[model samples]
Target chain A: MKKTKHKILDMLLKHPDIHLSGQKICDVLGCSRTAVWKHIKELESEGFKIEAIQKKGYRLLSTPNELSEARILVGLKTKELGQHLIYFDSIGSTQKETQHLAEDGAPHGTLVITSHQMTGRGRLGRTWSMPKGKGIAMSLILRPKLSINRIPQLTLIAAVAVYKAITEVTGIQTDIKWPNDILVMGKKIVGILTEMQTEGTNVKAVIIGMGMNINANKNDFPEEIRHVATSLKTLTGKEHDMSLIVQTILFYFEELYLRYLEEGFSVIKWMWESHAVSIGKRINARLFNGKVLTGLAKGIDEEGALLLEDDQGSIHKIYSADIEIE
Target chain B: MKKTKHKILDMLLKHPDIHLSGQKICDVLGCSRTAVWKHIKELESEGFKIEAIQKKGYRLLSTPNELSEARILVGLKTKELGQHLIYFDSIGSTQKETQHLAEDGAPHGTLVITSHQMTGRGRLGRTWSMPKGKGIAMSLILRPKLSINRIPQLTLIAAVAVYKAITEVTGIQTDIKWPNDILVMGKKIVGILTEMQTEGTNVKAVIIGMGMNINANKNDFPEEIRHVATSLKTLTGKEHDMSLIVQTILFYFEELYLRYLEEGFSVIKWMWESHAVSIGKRINARLFNGKVLTGLAKGIDEEGALLLEDDQGSIHKIYSADIEIE
Candidate 1:
């Protein structure tokens, strides 16, 4: 957002009920009254309902329904994360966009977000579709100086971050499904896909893509996933602001990510295990090699690999798999 | 190379000592005599010397000193490693190009080769410069269905392949330096870097980039690395054919890569250990996190991590590090 526009929005938001005169806005912003009126007009065009009176000046009635760079950044509380945000109305995949940005030497905490993704991506080459303006599809680019083996731990860290953000915003707790999903009552409310680009064992970038069904109704999802997916609005019977959710997630992500960097994966591993839904449950893991291992989920190892105790009481560290509670 | 050009080159290379008439070339290629003459002219322009007799035929005198697509493919014995090739006279970096190709759905074993690299890359953000027309810079894209943890093994496998190829071609055996470099008599001659793009522990594509100082002299290298770097021409006191070495390397790469997919890393691990110079030697390994551990280098484990036994006799698994023999 431009500096003057952000200042105007801040003043109007600070006092939502009162109208500030154009001369007062001009004095606060140190600009002409014509420039103040022009900024007001611009904000109105972006879906902000502004009431204009002959003597009472302008009152900001409501904000835009859509997400904008200004909207996500107005109250964002991060030092570096999301400071260099690239917002999109619609895109093929935020993950791909972040990958390209990372390749082009994007900063550490750059965020690429879209209101709608035409071709969303999920873990292991699965298709993820989200309704326009009803879901949050965002990819955060991180350049952590860690070994390649530790890259998987970032997924668990992200799951924990999203879990906390959603719970804090809605006052409704959500269960993290092992590595990447957030489940509400056995239905998936969020999906997280972490992709990495590495050179030999040196990591170039890690892009964490998260998609949450924020305001979608029962019929908004595709038929196949409708029975298995739930939304915050569907569960809470109200519309939740997506920009706030994005800001909260970014806030929590910065916090946990900094903690992981300073301390290690120990703190993150404990938090992940605490929120994981698959811990201590009887589950069947379909391994990448087309073999299924039926066992009891014994939580993740230090490296974030799922530890499964098979029927023979032997523990196997499953690196990549699709697990289901049996 | 175009189809007809490849066919013409193959015919000429088959009978290098004798002359083949344009009429015979036309009949074999199913093209016109004028077309055959045009191909001969094209070959001549690419540095192939041909002697045209009055009535007899055309005799192939010598091949090009520079690399060409037709030259490399003529006697190549690989199944699919270099079957689909993207050749360049000079490129920025074959690794970067191959990464882009992999993103665009390049098939497994797609090879990208360049006679020269403007900006060659070494592991851990090092610059690798090669003299024009004197080195081999190639990147191969492989889509292996393996867990992400196993991706590091591909670098060790590539080292073994390059070791075998150089020994077979130049008859001067080289030493595999733990993970990436191939050294001959305490000097670096070849470097291999394996990079990967992954989605949440699932391997998307692994690009194995190999850069070899094939025919460079001492003065061709930069002043800082001149004493530390040696090439095939410097070691053997004769110029080795670059195309023949490339073909040999690709042949061995395909054989060993297929064996890895079929059997496992056991075979490749054994091969790598046998040729490694760091095994059983006292070394200082500078890890990625800036801590240097001085230890005796044991052989690599099953997953290709270097097993280092420190002064206290405690063994540590070194995943990504630079080792210096003490």
Candidate 2:
């Protein structure tokens, strides 16, 4: 199958520093020499330069640099999360494509990633800083059989996944702010945008859009965002391995996803509570309509709304907003 | 402006009673006969058929069907509700198009109505029947500057508007069941599907997709749905004016919408409480996880969740599911 072939090539691609002979490649692949040669030839024709001299055997000289089906399959780790990856080298926005895919019945765990985004987006209609090959800008197309009431759990799950992945791979102490933002040293490093389709309270599909600053630098961020935006490389003082982080986060995400389906929010909510910063702090949440609610930031309620306990002991459950810890 | 020309032609199409000469049309339009003639010709090219004679000048033929900008403009009434009406005649789904537009900074209240949908949908990814020209299948795009907590108000407003419009035009006593479905004598007559875009709780835009059965007969109902769903004609024994109902609903909807922005849910909640069948009734709400809650259907809580009072007098708030009154 195409999936098996891509996996073999992906395993080879993962270790670019190593070289393998035809017998060794065939033994690991558990396939014949002719099939391996054919795959190597196919990879080279597709831009991957595989050195295939008679004695020298096979060595990965180069791989076709594309966000195409072949490359994404080879790059992705999870069995389901990004198994059916729909990647575009340059797109208007990955969120737009993911929405379309969900409408067209893309499986729950399918993902849409783009290398460059001409019309990239961030929270609150802000433009996302999306230079090609600098970050992971992808949208997970999920057909979660959940009520619209539990939709906020999608944001919480994504915040936890991205935070853990960044920390595990880049050694950056990234912290998730209340609802969605991921911050490193009090500067924003990742953003989560979620959209859902519902009829009344029945949720049809949920699109979890996550854009993480993987390799972008200080100059890449806009002047207005310079004071608050930071990247993984900027914080770690090196270019983090995007592949390893992608694998780890998606693996963790799928595990969390299964827990969400089986155990409901108990797992995700507990993990989010542990990962999040401002659980019991004094905070001011600024709503979209210019109204402000100042209270002690209590834990999230059962429905995912933040419970803010005011000085009068009245707890105002905030559904969605930008929160500032005072 | 382009809008003026569209307005003139649209007025003629919907008014079957109105007839005018080229000179009369020119006078009413405040334009030269040549300019009026040019717009009419453009309408003809776009699909509108205009009957032309020497004295019996520019009578819009009843059958000159077109999705011409002029036709849509003539039908739209509100200042903001349909300030920009995009008609595709046939699309994958109007909801998809409107979502794309909303993402691209299309002003809120931009309506997308199609005559036919290749992939029309209902809640929970169900296949909604959208036959060409027989039903009112359209998506109204709204950009309400309200928190995610207040977003559920749109569904309540839409359900009330749909219920009122159906009653006003057809004399049918429709009840708004909990959440958003419009039912006539215990069978669903209209369905409202609300999709939202949010960054945490700040709502960027909400698309309200309504699929109302207008002229379909009992035979038009799918075999599986024959027992549960009924159309306006099937129930009332008369075909109702869809456009008239759309206009009336929009007019009322705008009032309530403005009220919602100014006063929140105080007045609207009272209206919802008046017609709500579940209020004070014993009901069983089937949740997503196969758990059922049997309780008295109290009113909605401050955060828009349905309050269910158990036999023990403890209140359990239900969000997101179908409630069957036991």
Pull out the clashing pairs in model 1: none
True contacts kept of each: 0.79, 0.57
Model 2 lDDT tens row, B252-281: 788788888898888888888788878989
What value does the interface RMSD of model 1 take? Answer: 1.7
lDDT of model 2 at position B35: 87
Question: What digit string (tens of lDDT, one per residue) describes model 2 on residues A1-326?
Answer: 35556865776776677677778878877889888878777777656677666765766776543334576566566778987777676788898788767765689888887657778787777788765677778888777776566888888888888878777766777778878789878888788888875545556678888887777788887788789887877876777655566666787888787888898888788888887788888999997668999989888877778889998999998876789989
Candidate 1 retains true contacts at a fraction of 0.79
What is the model-wide C-alpha lDDT for candidate 2?
0.76
DockQ for the candidate 1 complex?
0.59
Instruction: Flag regions of model 2 displaced more than 4 Å.
Output: A1-5, A10-53, A60-77, A145-156, A185-187, A217-227, A234-237, A257-326, B1-6, B9-19, B27-53, B56-72, B185-187, B219-229, B234-238, B273-326
TM-score of each: 0.90, 0.80
The iRMS of the candidates, in order, is: 1.7, 2.9
Where is model 1 more than 4 Å wrong at Cα?
A: A1-8, A15-42, A52-58, A266-270, A295-298, A307-316, B32-34, B54-57, B311-314
lDDT of 1 by residue, B1-326 (tens): 34898888888888988889988888877999899899899989988898988678988898875677888888789878888889998999998888878866799989999978999898876888898889989999999888777889999888888899899978999999978999999999999999899887778999999889988888999899987888999999988878888888889888998999899999898889999999989999998779999989989988889999999999999888889999
